[model samples]
Target: MKNASFGVLLALQFLTRIPIPIAVPWTPDTRRWAVRVYPLVGLMIGSVLTLIAFAMQNVPAPITALAVLSVWVALTGGLHLDGVMDIADALGSNQPLARRWEIMKDPQIGSFAMLALVFLLAWKAVLLWALLAYQAPLWWLLIVPGLGRWAGVALLVLTPCAQQKGLAWSWQQSLSAQDVALALLPLAFIALLAPAALLMWLTVIVFVVLVRWAMMRLFNGINGDMVGATIEGGELWLLILVWSWWQFATVSPPGI
Candidate 1:
């Protein structure tokens, strides 16, 4: 129980800018538990966004959407966004695998990275606006973040590390199939909250598979930046799915 408590704090500290006053030791056991609780960290983030959404429920959706987007970026301190940029710069370089790694390591933002950030934030902002304006279920805001992080956990567990060092490699080393299964238990509870959410979970699984395949093809294996990109991309894709459902589907999303 103490280890699990520390693991939650470790995940929150690593994944978000939220201040966790407790000191968490860096150890193999805590790291493995941190992996197990990644989704919970995300749910914590989503809960914050949901609160913001409710607080500004009456405000103009464009303004509210931007507010939500800003909070989202601020909360994570753009950690995953950095990953998106790094991956974009690497892939856009069109170099060999080794050269791509070199490009990703470069601190300078290239044209591709700038474009990727713009498009990603733009899509997120617009989707948040649509969801708010159209009155999609607010619980989805909670679910998507957890789903995104779970996608990261899945990628970490299922893919080989691009390098034998670094945090991603360490997490991959520490995680096991049981940890992965434990991480998924939260999602099962979420499914019980909204049976319709199973569709979104299915979508996340497909996204993870495609991302894993692409990472193998492009980077030759997974890395921290790739996992971060997976989280950001997963969140965006889930947002897109919810918007599409609200816009076109005949059935109403549960709770709406």
Candidate 2:
């Protein structure tokens, strides 16, 4: 297979539970290319979930929200949520940076992580229900995950990795101007689609900047977990903004 074709499979394999039968060599170049196509993985996830939700449009909003959330988690294998939990544990440790790093690496879930997981998941469900209840455009779902992963890509290229080793370090060290440019093509696609999408892209960029600053202040740099957390955070923010717009627009709001 061509490198581009292989890169697509690699991106899918890395981002979701989807199986890609082709095996691609795991070189730094391949990894960079895979990251370049990361947004495509989001597009694929959003398309499936949007279709499912639309098919069940007649179902109660709360139940539809729960079902979509379940599929979203299963599709990504809770990859970003794990990052959220790790970062929460590290941040809540209140220990020195070194100890906090160790705490992040621990396999056991801490109380902080558990509480964060509960709140984050519940909040996401609530936001999803709001979107469903409002009868917002389902096509916007295609933009949500892409924006989230794009935030991850932004961190990968723009931030310094806190640790001397790990996937983030490797990606940062290997990233090139070309990689950054290629990764951003998805934003152009979003911008051409609608004014709301442009707004969504801007929101993701702003949130990524804020989160990147927080990571530097707390962790001294970015990491795999921080990147993952950024993805989840970006997605949540997009949902909220879309929901808010739907609620306040000239159209009548849906009955709760």
Candidate 3:
């Protein structure tokens, strides 16, 4: 592709059924740029879900919430959530590191895997309940998931890969300061779009700290699972912060 950056994003959207395509090779450089542009995927995802939620708002609240969740799940093909499930199952089992790796590697779902999916879906449901109830600031959806994916990009760019080669390594190896710099540029421009631009940075900071701690305790180093988990968890953490901020703004008085 002429522009590797958009090509990378095209690849993500291609995976997500966004109707974009890569006529050229999915080169390492292109993949790296995709990581940078990964936020756009989130932006698209959030936008679609928000619009669906907005359209269904006059519909029953629960129905609207289901529509939002349905579209969100459909957009990404449930890839990140799958990551969240594998990682959660691995973590919940309290198995040794090697065994955990084996479990993560296994395609077959386990009890913990089932638990993880249930918990994640439940959390997303509750979160959507709050967001749909109040109908969260649509702009934040644009910023939060975009920034969370950036956190995943930052993590890959910073650390050495646990495995020698894979899609994750393709990213780890291909990414550079220039790519990271370019990625931030669009986000910087987004600050003018909303104050949540700064809150987005807070999401990055929190993910880095929390993921670093979790990786050290759980995985001991980076892996594809880590990438997926970071994207999913960081998104949730950022959303949780947004909810807390909303609660702060409008909660009723104690005397009431």
RMSD of 3: 2.9
Q: How many residue pairs clash in each candidate?
A: 0, 0, 0
- Report the C-alpha lDDT of model 3 over 3-65, residue by residue, as the tens digit: 665666554764375555446566776676676677666666666776776667677666676
lDDT at residue 126 of model 3 (Cα atoms): 74
What C-alpha RMSD separates each model from the true structure? 2.6, 1.5, 2.9
Model 2, 1-256: lDDT tens digits are 3666777878888899987777787777778888898987898898889988999999999999999999999999999999999989988989999999999999999999999899999989999998898888886787888889988998878889887899889767767767866876866776686767877888887998898888889889988988899889889888888888888883777787
lDDT per residue for candidate 1 within 18-97, as digits (tens), equals: 88888798888888889898998888889999999999998888999999999999999999998999999988988988
Candidate 1 Cα misplacement greater than 4 A, ranges:
250-256
Q: Please, what is the TM-score per model? A: 0.95, 0.95, 0.88
Question: Model 1 misses residue 150 by how many Å?
Answer: 0.3
Instruction: Provide the clash count, candidate 3.
Output: 0
Clash pairs, candidate 1, are none
